[model samples]
Every structure is written in structure tokens, then in C-alpha cells.
Target: MDASELDIVDRPAASARGWRVPLLAFARNPAGSIYGTVVADSVLAVESERQTKLSDLIYAELITVIVYWFAHVYADFLGSPPSGSRRASLHRLAVTLGHEWSLVTASFFPLAAVLLAAAAGASIQTAALAGMWTGVAALVLWGQLAGRRAGRGAVVSFAYGMTAGLFGLALILLRVLLH
Candidate 1:
């Protein structure tokens, strides 16, 4: 089904519970979730190494995701054929942005992890690590969901999950190499 169909399935519930829609959208946009998580992890790794404060780190991560989301939306909107009417063009822009909203939503859990860890009195570094791991876990979960959605068996699904987790690991490896 196309994005419009997916939007029809999600838009009403999304309007009712804005915060929850992204989690639901995950099934439809696993790639967006993975992309967001990888980006979040990269930001966390780099900022944590800088010994940044938790508040600053969180703000930076959020702003980074938003900027990327806007960029993705703009690129997608540009790639679409130009609509005839101005209203139609605006609608297309809205649809493109809404479709890419998963990028911002995917960062929610990892940011929450960082906030929760800090609330529990963890150091900024440790809290950032928690957030990074949460992103990794999200990636793995998205992979498993995708596999199952495709009717794969449990073992193969798990392998897919691990493979997705590798993206996070690669960022971690880069962190280690840089530091």
C-alpha cells in the first residue's frame, strides 16, 4: 500500500494521541526508525565523548534529529512531481513531512532513556550510554518486527535483529577508534 493508505490507517489515531503514533508508525516505517536510531546513537556517542552536560546533550540530540527530519522531508517533497494547484502543493508538502515524522519519533525512546538515567542520578556519560543502548535495542526490535512482518521464522528473525543491531555497533566502534 502507498503512504496515503498508511496515513489513512494512522491519521485519526495519530490526531487523538500524537505521542503514540510514532510507535505505531514503526511497523510501516522500519527504515525510518532505523535511520533515526543510528543518527541518535551517533550523536550520543560523540556528545558523550565531549563530556557534555545531560541537558545540553539531550537538546543537541533533539535538534539534530529535527534538522535531519526537515532535510529528509524537504528532499522527499522536492522529489515528488509538482502538484497543479497551490493547495495541492501544500498538501503534498504536509504529507511528505508527516510521512517522515518517524525520524523524530524514533528518537523519543533513546532521549527518554537518557533523561531517566539522569533522574536516577547517573552521570552524564553513563546516561548517554544508556540512551545509546536504547537506540541499539530499538534498531534490533525494528528489525525483528520487519522480519516477522515478512513471515520469517523466529531464528531468521533474530538474525535480522542482530544484523540491525550491528549498525549501532559500528557507531560504537567508531567512537572507540576516535577516542
Candidate 2:
């Protein structure tokens, strides 16, 4: 059949929910947390000579998260600005940059939660667990939303959510094992 003779699929207008693209982009950008955990755990494990406190471990991990987050943000900022003749007003530019930067920043929230919990005198182990779960939950929710947007059924969407969570967790496990 000639290309023009094929029927078009009725679909969503791309401009609608345009914000979702960036929101998903922000949600998906946090691989560094795993890397940070591994690095922090390994360094603290080796350097302390004695056992490190749970608070200390989580704090160190949080620092690593921030460092990796910073690198990611800086790199993105360099690549994020609009190119060529496309120009935005100062306010638009500010908003664009803020949204772009959020992609890198969102990953830190989980670790920040851990930090706050620890500061409040919670056990590092417990706080870390909560933080990790928070991140995983975010991933799963994002996945579910994504699947729904793609017209998946409820079961399929739930499965997609678990898949996203498990995939991220697997990467985290791999980093932990390797480090």
C-alpha cells in the first residue's frame, strides 16, 4: 500500500500533557543514588578501621548522592540551554533552566529524606531503608503513570510499575555487590 493510503491512528495531541515529558525526564535521572551508596559504603567501610555508625554511613552516602547529583546537574546545564536562533525571554529562560535543573535535582530528595530522618535521631539503617524505599516508590509510580499513558490495562500498568522499581533496585544491588 502507498504510505499516504494508510489510515491514521487517532491519538493524543502531542502538545497536550507536554509537561509530562520533562517530568518523566526528571523522574528518570537518578542513577547516581546507587552509585553514591556504593561509593560511600565502600569508602566508609575501608577508612573507618572500626565499625561506622549508621548515621555516619547514611550521611556519607548522602554526601555522595549530592556530589553525583551536582555533576549530573552541571553536565545537563551545559547541554540544556536552547541552541541556534530559538530565543526565549529572560523569564522563559529562567523557567526553562529551572525545569531542566529539576531533572538532576529530583534524585536527591530520597537521600535528603534519609538525612533529615537521621538528623532527627532515627537509626541510620532505618532512615536509609526509608530513603531507598522512597526512591523505589517514585520509580514505580512513574512507571504506572507511563503505562497508563500508553493505554495499558491496570494489571499491565502495575506490572510496569514493578518492573521499573525492580530494574532500579537491581542496578543498586549490582553496584553494592561490585563495590
Worst 10 residues of 1 by lDDT: 19-28
Clashes by residue pair, model 2: none
Candidate 1 lDDT over 71-125, as tens digits, reads 9889888888989999999998997777777788888878999999999999988
Point to the candidate with the largest TM-score.
1
List model 2 lDDT by residue over 37-137, tens digit each. Answer: 33333333332333247646645655655565567556654666555544544455555445444333545655576667778886655565556656566
Which runs of model 1 end up more than 4 angstroms from their true locations? 1-28, 149-156
Candidate 1 structure, TM-score to reference: 0.80
Each model's lDDT: 0.83, 0.54
Alpha carbon lDDT of residue 160, candidate 2?
78
Native-to-model Cα distance after best TM-score fit, residue 53 in candidate 2, in Å = 8.8
